[model samples]
Each structure stands twice: as C-alpha cells, then as structure tokens.
Target: MQLDDLRQNWETFGAENPMWAIYTGRGRIEWDEGEFFATGDTEISEVMAVLERHGAPSGAARALDFGCGLGRLSQALAAHYETVDGVDISEPMIEGAKALARQPTGVDESRLRYHLNTKADLSIFEDESFDLVFSLITLQHMRPEFSRSYIAEFCRLVRPGGVVFFQLPTHRTTALKRLRGAAGRTMRKVRRSLLGGEPVMEMYGTPRKDVEALLTTGGLRVLDVLPDELAGPSWQSFRYLAIRPDSGD
Candidate 1:
C-alpha cells in the first residue's frame, strides 16, 4: 500500500478502535484503561532491560517512539527517560494520546508529548535528537521503500552512542505461507481498485541483507538481530539492535 492508503487505514482504525487496532488480540470493548497502559510498562521494561545488557545509549535523557499508536510505548518510555515524544500518522491517535496523558494515572504530561507526522521521513525532528529511537510492530505495514527511509531516519535521529531498535519481517517461513502472502497482497490491490471503500491493512518485508546494508549506509553498527514473534506465525521477523558509534569530540 502507498503512504496515503496507510494513513487512511490507520486513521480509521485510530478513530474507531485505537487500542484494538494496535493490539489486535484485544476486543474492541475489552481494553481496560489501566491494563492497556500496563502492557506498555511491561514491554518498555523488557526493552530497557535488553538495552542495559548491551550498555547502550550513554544516557537516558530523551526517547522517540515512531508510529506510537496512542502513546502505548511512548508513555512507558517516560519512566526511563526524562522525556518521551510519540509520533503517529493519524490525528485521532495523537489526540487520543494527548487526552490519555492528561489523566492522573497516565504518564506525567510534562514528560510525554505526541506529534502528528504524515510525511515519509522524520524531518520534523532534528538529527541526533534522541538517546533512544524505537519502533515496534510499526514498519511492517508500509512498503519497504518507505520503511527503509524511516529506518535510515532512525539511524540519523539517534544520538551518537544511542541505540535504534525496530522490527521487520524478512520473509515468510514456508513456501505455502509465501504464496499466501503474495495472494493476499494481490487480493488487497484488486479490492482497493474495485471497491475503494475502507482501507485494507497490508504487510511487506525487506530482506535481511538489504536491511543490514541500509543500517550500515546510515552509519549504524549492527549489534544483534534477535528473532521476534511480532510478525505473527506465518512470517519470519526480527528485531534489529544497532548503535551509532560515538563521535570523539
């Protein structure tokens, strides 16, 4: 799908069922306010622990959460960093995130902020603006050209000595699954062309080699690539852990 199609689909999802769209396992009316944010805490805690093991990102002053649907991960990052910024493509999602942050139970309003960015690149934020640049289950939805550019942006946005962690599928694990994925994409294209109604969700992958080369081109040092379950059962996905080499001043 193109960027406009992605934005339209996610905007609808954000308006109708923000929480359910981010985490599909939850029912539309079933997301408990407290429990939903708590999942963010758990996820960020695990991510921080992993980073700690590698001695990453010399400081924890600021963080940026790309594609931060309703600030789920952004709010959680606030506990570790002094401030957190959440950027999303949908206006409703950003508005919902701001509203949630106003509550007493939400992350401190002063420490967390949300931004609406519909552009393909993160030009709104200056280079090396964050100690940790993160994205989760966000890149797989867009085509690789867009996703690759964002990955390069992740590398640029992170401060020297900081880390960039994101997930993307490399390919389907089985031939049947590959056929199914191709067929699904073809059907979605046909549906969009013929019906032109609600936006359909799509999945795309960048080969591992291309991803590594992109990171290298962005001047990030590949640290580790861990297999992750975020891409679902049919696809083989991985979370890349990389760091920008510190500049000797």
Candidate 2:
C-alpha cells in the first residue's frame, strides 16, 4: 500500500478502535495500564538477555526502539538507557506510545520520546546518535528493497561499537512448518489473505539468508541468529544481533 493509504488506514483504525488494546492483545474491551501486548513477556525477556549478554554500557545508553508499537518496549528501554526514542510508521501507535510515556511511573519520563516514520528513512535523527537500536516483529513488514535501507539506517544510527537487533519470520521455515500441520496451514492462509493480491509492505517475507546478506552488505557484522523456538514448539522466527565495525576493532 502507498504510504498515505497506510497512514490513513492506521489513523482510521486508531480513531475508531483503541490501537493499544488491539495491537497488544490486551483484550478488546479493556486496557492494561501495567502490561504490554504486541510483544509478549517471553520475547521481551529474551531481548533483554541478549542485550545483557552483549554487555549494555554503563549509565544510560542512548537507545532507539524502531517500530515501537504502543511504546511498551520503549518505556522499558527508558529504565535502562539515558534516553529512549520510539519510532513507528503508524501515527496512532505513536499517539498511544506518547500517552503511555506521560503516565506517572517510576521510569524517568524525561528520557522518552516518540517519532512517527519508517526506519528506512530516519532523516529526523542524526547519524551515530544512539548506543543501541532494536526492533521486534517490525522488519518483516518492510518491503525488501526498503529493508536493505532500514538495516543501513540502523547501522548509521548506532555509534561505531553499538549494537542493532531485529526479528523476522523466516520464509522457508514458515512454509515448511505450514505444510506439516493444520494450524500452520491456517496461519499461512491468514497471512496470504492479509497480503490481498497486493504487496503489503509489512508482510514482506524475508528469508534468513537474505536478511544476513543485507546486514553484511550494509557493513554490519553478524553476532548471532537465535532461532525463535530452540527449546520448544513455536513460530519460526529469527533474531539477529550485529554491531557496526569500528575504525579498528
């Protein structure tokens, strides 16, 4: 869909429906002031673990949460980073995020901000301004051509030793899984319907090799590619971590 159409769709969706509750799985009729949806606790915990394993810098690392829906992870990042900026393509998502940031919580509200835009073009933010950049279930939605640019932007936003991470559904694995079971087939049908005979920028299927190639071509070094359900049965997804090569590392 065109950017304007996508924006209008989200705006209408947000205006008529509470985006926060819908996107976060917080229930249709109720909203949870203390919990986050869209991304589950298990995924958040895994992200934190990966960040910690890589060694978060001491005392407030400037961080960026790309595709930060409803500011759930953005709010969490604020607690650890000196400043946390949440960026999303959907204006309603950013609106809900901004609202969440304003609530009186133990987190330092002064350190959080929201931007509405795509990751492929983050012209609003200066280069090398962040210590860490991350996104969850957001990259897969970007068009393949734009995905390359988004990875480049992620690299540009982080300082020379800064880390960047993102998750994408693996096309090959997902397809194989779909062929194995009724539930998987149902999921495949749902996904195909969502595409609706037109290229949905967000529904772009990215394979693991393609994503790794993009990162490598973008001048970032791969640190890891953790399988989504290494320990149990779950959707096939991959999380990638990479760092910008310093002048001399």
Q: By lDDT, who's the top model here?
A: 1
Q: If scored against the real structure, what TM-score would every candidate get?
A: 0.95, 0.77
Give per-residue CA lDDT, model 2, range 198-217, as digits (tens). Answer: 22223445678888887787
Collision pairs in model 2? 24-38, 60-82, 141-202
- Candidate 2's TM-score: 0.77
lDDT of 1 by residue, 1-249 (tens): 778889999999899888888887444466988889998999888888889898875344788999999888888888888898899999999999999988788878878989999999999999999888999989998999999999999998998888898989999899998999899889988988998876667878889999999999999999988898788887889989888988872
CA displacement after TM-score superposition, residue 224 of candidate 2 (Å)? 0.6
Local distance difference test scores for all models: 0.88, 0.68
